[model samples]
Target: MAKKDKSEKKKKSAKLKDAEREARLEISGDLGTAITQASRSLRTVQTRLLTRSGLYSGQEGVVLLLAAEEGLTPGLLAQRLGVKAPTMTRTIGRMEAQGFVERRGSDADGRQTKVYLTETGRATVDRISSANKALERQATQGLSGKEIKVLMKLLAVVEDNLHAQMPAELPEPIDESEDLAAE
Candidate 1:
């Protein structure tokens, strides 16, 4: 029993070492890692600015879209934004609670509800726009116009490559209960 216990300890140590090495290998020189880090930092900065205007990170996108086109059904908005229906529904619900948006039953189809910006929501457009412009200026502080254009093109290529390789639908979330025992 002692020998078996020793062997199990060795196995666990080896697994831990392997996991550490794998993590180091991936982050050191990976483009995806760099992109993820940049995105996270940008989001943090944007969130700070947006919070000052009584908006969350993703909420600005919804406000901008509705500002551009009013009376969009939730389903249509979800499709345009490339988010799931339930996600859009929750966002609209929260925005409605905040008095930023209103949903009215469509005259053509009573079952379908169309979303529109409330007067308060319309007033928020300028603040959102200013926040976005500030973010852009901060992000591009050291880059030249030509360099910025090139960077955009390269990022677009990377995005296109990843999109092409992406799965048609994401898989269900993994169950980590078995792994928790080891932890």
Candidate 2:
């Protein structure tokens, strides 16, 4: 009878271990979902603020870059922004249509097109800078400086872990110009 009791005890322990593992996995999934939702919410707020400055979500980065240094080629701009060349080309085209930027062929390299900010682009970049400051302040409203720093560190760690598992080469980004035309 004692041997039988010991066997039952072992079974219970195994089941407890399995339950604990399942709970941990569920918590991890919940954390991932929460992070994704938070990112989406922040982007929504940024888009609204950027619209007030006569810019779109991704255009502010371009304007900010050009404001710091004029006459950057699309390839260099795309590399700096970590986007594909075609994507940058489309973005530059839109900014050109908006009268915020102009593209000129490089005198040194005929094949290379360099982007320059118009006067309107310069003023918009200033407004974008101010809006960014306001957005950051609003996002961290109740958090202390130390708390914000800790939060940033934790996020960086999470990003590093994901990057470690990512493939060396990601698939090429698709050009969305055709989709835009269809719309």
Candidate 3:
């Protein structure tokens, strides 16, 4: 009975070691390790800045996108951000409450809502953008110019691959008629 107990203990110990080995192997690969590490590091920086600035991640991106686009619908903002409509709607609502954005009924289509950044939102985006640039420079201290370029290209490829794998509808080219009509 003692021998049998020892044998079972040995098997259990071996299985535990094997599990640990597999976990290590899974994260040892370059793609997995780099992605995990980069996400962790980026989140740390983002959270720090966000905490200090009293902003949320998705909300800040929305502000910057709105700053550039001037007047975009929540549908268009969701498409640009690659998020779902409900998610963008909630974020925009929060921003609206914070006095960062305002929504108005579109003259072209009263049923459709158009989002515009308030002066407060534009100013916040500008401030956050400058802070983000400084934080990014500090984050990429050791990388060379070529390394930075390659890193961006590789990340873009990874993003494209992930989006290519998704089953969602892709964006279409803008209609010239729509642009002229808007003008």
Candidate 4:
């Protein structure tokens, strides 16, 4: 009877271990989906707030960066903003048309162009700051400060992990000539 009881206990423990493993697997699979969904939702909220300040989703970073430093080339802006030069050019053109920023030839270098915020753009800085504060408040409405800090730390770790896995540069193109020679 005692032997049968011990056997039953071992089987129950094995079942529990399997159940825990499945739970961990499910959570690991859900992490990416959760992060993506959260990001989309946050962006939606941010866009809505930015619209009130006469800016779009990507324009705020440009405005804020230009506000801090009066003149920056579109290429520098693209690099800092993690976007391509052409995208930054389009954004600058739109902002110029909207009277938010203007491009001028660099005094130090005749060929280089520098972007500067207009009076309208400078005025919108306060509004942008307010919007950011409001967004933060709303996002952290339920969370404690300690929880928010932990979340930030966890996210940084995740971002670092992802960055570590990404290739530093694209692979070189294969030479068709070499391929033909090999063939």
Candidate 5:
């Protein structure tokens, strides 16, 4: 079974390499490559810190958002996060089970459920926020103030482009089989 898994991974890597080479040739300093690599590196560190402290990469953002706004509907949270309702549903399910959040029917709309952070979530999120600030400081140790501002602006542009290009908030697709297998 392990050998098969290894072979499958090797095949996938080879395919990605071919695609990357093709992309690199077509676009000098491919924006996608740089964006993907940087995103992966950040996610790795973020995930490590979050997982170590019993959280997930995007989950902390949810907690923080809820912390700031106590009665955000799930739909509102999804809108804020640029995720689909179902995706928010699943993530909130995990969070709710973990005692990081509580869901209640919206006062305005019985059909809508609101997400609220719990006391435990507040403490957990505060720790994660401190950890994130530390990581950001370490990552930007040598950058000048101007450079940091420029980088932030550039990232904002990228984010805006993505949302502008796609109006629908699609749920981030998951390889459910892999997720279930992990469980």
Candidate 6:
């Protein structure tokens, strides 16, 4: 009954292939979920650390950027920070109210306003650096240098792939201001 044996073998092979495909799909789904969970946890930790500096989750980026190069326009800041103009404007307003940054009319172009870090913001620079180093140390506590390097490279590749598939016009960013304010 060679024909019967061959038919049974073929059926088993097809089942195995199906099982492998399902496993791959499950693994991919888990990968996405894990990435999302990790990102959220990291942000939560960062927010907690930033609160000590009287900064929110997003304001630190503005402070750091201005620390490096002062007098950057809100539009340029938004572009560099990968956020919308409205978002940057809101962030700058909040920072100004907190006395971390101040805006002034540009000498070259009166219509344009440039942002600069205030004394308070500069003072927090060292604290922000310490907070960041602490976070890094905590996150990579068990990981080797090679593992961290590999992880960074893998994340970069994933980010590039996702960006390549994104549309020219991205969706609006989530408004985390309320959450930050509550904190």
Tens-place lDDT per residue, model 2, 1-183, is 999999999999879978986776677577787688668878888999999877888999999899999999999999999899999999999999998999999999999889999999998977887888888898887589999999999999999998688777997987889889989
Clashes of 3: 0
Write candidate 1's Cα lDDT for 1-183 as tens digits.
Answer: 999999999999979978975786677667777788778978999999988878877888889999999999989999888899999999999999998999999999899899999998998899988988898899877589999999999999998888788787998886889789879
The per-model lDDT (C-alpha) reads 0.89, 0.90, 0.83, 0.92, 0.85, 0.91
What is the alpha-carbon lDDT for the whole of candidate 2? Answer: 0.90
lDDT per residue for candidate 5 within 1-183, as digits (tens), equals 999999999999979978986786567466887778767878888888788778987898898898788989888898999899999999999999998999988888899778888887888867888879977886676589899999999999988887687646877887889989999
Q: Model 5 segments beyond 4 Å from truth?
A: 1-29, 166-183
Give the per-residue lDDT digits (tens) of candidate 4, residues 1-183.
999999999999979978986776677577887688678878899899999988989999999999999899999999999999999999999999989999999999999999999999999899889999998898877589999999999999999998788877988987889889988
Q: Report the lDDT of model 6 for residue 35.
A: 82
Residue ranges of candidate 2 with Cα displaced over 4 Å: 1-29, 165-183
> Which predicted model would earn the best lDDT?
4
Runs in model 1 deviating more than 4 A are 1-28, 167-183
Q: Alpha carbon lDDT of residue 64, candidate 3?
A: 84
Clashes of each: 0, 0, 0, 0, 0, 0
Off by over 4 Å in 4: 1-29, 167-183
lDDT of 6: 0.91
Pairs of colliding residues, candidate 6: none
For each candidate, C-alpha RMSD in Å? 14.7, 16.2, 16.3, 12.4, 14.7, 15.8
How far residue 52's Cα lies from its native spot in candidate 1, in Å, is 1.4
- Model 3: how far residue 126 lies from native, Å: 2.0
Which ranking of candidates, highest lDDT first? 4, 6, 2, 1, 5, 3
